[model samples]
Target: MLSMLKRIIIGAPLKSTELGEQKLNKKKALAILSSDALSSVAYGPEQILLVLVTISAVAFWYSMPIAVGVLFLLTALILSYRQIIYAYPHGGGAYVVSKENLGENAGLVAGGSLLVDYILTVAVSVSAGTDAITSAFPGLHDHNVIIACLLVVFITILNLRGITESASILAYPVYLFVLALFILIGVGIYKIITGDVSSDLHAPIGTPVAGISLFLLLRAFASGSSALTGVEAISNAIPNFKEPGPRNAVRTLMAMGLLLAILFSGIVFLAYYFGIAPKHEETVVSQIAAETFGRNFMYYFIQGTTAMILVLAANTGYSAFPLLAFNLAKDKYIARMFTMRGDRLGYSNGIITLGVTSILLIIIFKGQTEQLIPLYAVGVFIPFTLSQTGMLVKWLREKPKGWAVKLAINLTGALISFLVMMMFFITKFSQVWAVLIFLPLIVLGFHQIKKHYVAVGDQLRLTTCEPIKPIEGNVIIVPVAGMTHVVENSLNYAKSLSADQIIAVYVSFERVDEKIFEDKWNKWQPDIRLVTLQSYYRSIIQPLTKFIDTVEKKASESNYRVTVLIPQFIPKKSWHNILHNQSSILIRTFLLYKRNVIVTTVPYHLKK
Candidate 1:
């Protein structure tokens, strides 16, 4: 049943020839790999508002400043990641960066951070998207968790089908939403600056907080930083691009950075200009849309587009988690299952795992965007800081012509990112840290696993030993059931051993059929003499033990050695035990009690 389920999940094993036919090309690869970052524009603005709503009604106006900060960080991150693409283009991302420069522990920290961040990306994006849809359609407001889980299952199915397949379907719609967002923000900005926009527009039906403190400002900044989550995704995907992969990847990164900055900043400014304050009860995007576009076509349009983009955002984690797992697997830090690509040249297992985990988070949090937002920013910034610091370490080690300039840039970026990460941890720790404790635990688990592998490798090392001397009059009595495949294999194996003499014997229970026994013996036609001992009580173990004891007594008296060959069939299938049973282990145990007799097994494979 488990095998059947595995087959259903991953499909039947493909022939060698079928593998090459399914390889993904550059365009298709980019679609699959780039979707994560491209999808973030949908919920990035909403996340900022969620944080600000807790402070004061006017805090939402600060979304513009928060977006500006995110844009600045995004730019720095893109440039830094471009360096990463050029330096480690084989695709390890943060792991490779830290390992090459800062050492293994640093690499593990980076990898752990990236892994946690990817998971949060999926959960936060899907939930936020559901929130947008629910705002647009009141009926769905109560079923957020259910809807989010269904979306996750749908995405998992799409991914299971293959990377190129999912990419081809999701890419156009994602691009469409990107373009639509650009238009909406651009037009909205124009209307705002020209004083044509209505100032009476406010977030629909939800009260904004009245007072704020310094802590509120910091919290808003951290929440807004969610927009920066997918900035590293392109760096991780560098190897998946076309030839001149690093250069193409850098270009893609720059393009993504510029687009994200413009769209995120523009939307935040528009939301603030129109008095769309963030409220605990409703998302700022939904509130703004309901005001600007009314409860009619435009409001629904923005909501629908946001939902599509959010669903697609999960593609980011889908692209990242597999590559991260692959890198760890290669370093022996993770299981080998992650290292192999699927039939469609995708990491199907990793993709499905990410999807399932994201769905579980959705269910646990009941798909509340507000609830999940607190847990979102820390993991991402932790890696962001570590990767940026790694770049500084790399820059110092290389000491290039522009070393001083690059060092300063990286140092500043690292400091800023690190400070923000600290702020996120401090302000949001109680609210979200408990849920995130698993991140460090996962890292510790992988470290222990690596240690176990090292220990096993050390234990298995071979050493030189003296050769055995043959004894005169030594007889190896190998017990057999019949001339079955296992028995024949055992006889053949024993003959090749450095033994003085070999003897084949069979023991039968009282219930055994005489005709079957005779036919089984005839098949092998043993070159060596065969002996059979019978039991009156239908107990093979007791009879075999008595026979071996008698043979050993004779051998000991003659100063000879006795060895036994036990034939055994190891059950492969779960159902095989119902059809046939063997007592090789019991017989071997009895022989061990009698001194001077050696026992060995010849195994036969059973169909699984």
Candidate 2:
């Protein structure tokens, strides 16, 4: 029943041979991988105005300059990561680049930061998407957190189904979103050119309540930096593309960057010229749409697509996190389960884990995008800075053809990212303190996991010349509940083994006639010795475990192996298991850790 439900939700199991066929093309890959970066246009420029508006009404005019700065950084990052895609086509992104050019510690830091960023991506994107919905229907505003969590679950299941499947499912809304924004931008530009401006276009700018400082500009820049969060995703997932993976990935990266630049700049420019102010009940983009299209079908269409693209933006995190986790797991820094592929050939464990974690963040932050934004950009820029620095180091060391130009590009990216990261730390220190604290702790956790795996390998490893030690014989002890077919089956298997002795032991809480028990044992004629012990406390496992311990000590003294066979009867239906005694399971659980003791369950299947 459970299997049928899983099949229905996630679809049929896919074959390993179908993996190459699952890769996405440039058009579909752009939609899937770049949704997070593109969707940031829904909120990125707004984040800048959100910061600047707090200082004074006139201060919001500075959003254009801040946005231009963000665009410059985005260009540098696009150039730097295209180089990354070609340099390491296998695709580990910043983590691999830093680890190879830099050292192990730098690699771990980059990996940890990316992990945090991916999780935040899901939380923030979904929350902002929910905000768009609530903006359209104020009645749903109170339930936004619940709505955001449900969206995360939906996207997670889509990704778990397979990469190609999700790309096909999500591509329509992504393209529709881009088209909607383009229409909005083009119409808004034409209105400005033809002087069909809004009624409030010439409203006087408000007086400044406070003077603008360098710190204020930096704060706005830092806030707007969220626009660049998903730019690194393409470099990290080159293998997800079809033939000519590196070439396809770089092309997609360039396309995503170009789209993001135009969308972000156009939105910021329109919002400034139209004099759209940030509002508590509605989003900046929503207001711009209302001003441009006048609440018609076009206005609602823009809102619908914006909400969809924002919600689907979480798809970027779903796509990248599992692959990043696979790389980390391959390096032995995380559990090996993350490295295992499911029936669909997706990293099921990593996908499910990312979903659960982001849901938790959404719940904790109450699904407020502004509240979560403070903790967002810090994780992003850490890896951006590290990736640039790692590439710079690589160029200096290799000095390949055109290395000088590459070095200059990466150097500029590294410096700008580092400065922006420092501004995030300084301006939002109170909110981002937790992320700063978690970065080192997460790296330390990676080291500890690696140390443990290394130690286990050392113990389990064997040399070619090493000789095996032989055991003397087996001492079999079967823990029985009573004389039944299950006991007979266990005793038969024990007798088949070449053992020195075989004994059946039982623990009874109620007093029994010794003479009657012995008579019954003799009547059975099983030819196996039976030992029964009375338990004063009515505890079955404690008394049985003690007997096994005594037998193990004696067996170890003689260099013999001790085997404990637990007999149990199988129920035809899984729900029927609750009707029977579970003492055999308890006995097996107790003897698991005993020295020189091996516990095995002998099942007697019921045809019913």
Positional deviation of 562 in candidate 2, in angstroms? Answer: 1.3
TM-scores for every candidate against the unseen true structure: 0.74, 0.95
Candidate 2 lDDT for residue 150: 92
Q: Give the runs in model 2 whose Cα sits over 4 Å from its true position.
A: 198-210, 464-468, 513-519
Clashes per candidate (backbone, < 3 Å): 2, 0
Error of 1 at 343 (Å): 2.0
lDDT of 1 by residue, 190-268 (tens): 7777888876664333345467666776667777776677778877866566667788777777777776777777777
Best by lDDT: 2
Q: List the residue pairs that clash in candidate 2.
A: none
> What's the CA error at residue 427 for candidate 2, in Å?
0.5
lDDT against the true structure, per candidate, is: 0.73, 0.89
Q: Could you tell me the lDDT of residue 362 within candidate 2?
A: 90
